[model samples]
Target: MGGESNRSLSLLHESQNKINSSKDVFLEKCL
Candidate 1:
């Protein structure tokens, strides 16, 4: 159970990073 939750957390973190990077790209284009 602990291992499964850890994997989920990492996956969420990766997705969060992807979202942040995409937002940055969008902001650059808006400028």
Candidate 2:
């Protein structure tokens, strides 16, 4: 159970990072 939770948390963090990077790119283009 602990391992499963850790995997899920890592996946979520990765997705969030991707989203933030994309947002940064979009804002840079707008500038």
Q: Give the candidate number with the greatest TM-score.
A: 2
Model 1 TM-score, all chains together: 0.91
Per-candidate local distance difference test: 1.00, 1.00
Per residue, candidate 1 scores C-alpha lDDT tens digits across 1-31 of 9999999999999999999999999999999
> 1-31, model 2: which lDDT tens digit per residue?
9999999999999999999999999999999
Q: Global CA lDDT of candidate 2, please?
A: 1.00
Clashing pairs counted in every model: 0, 0
Q: Candidate 2: give its CA RMSD in angstroms.
A: 0.3
> Which portions of model 2 miss their true places by more than 4 Å?
none
lDDT (0-100) at residue 3 of candidate 1? 100
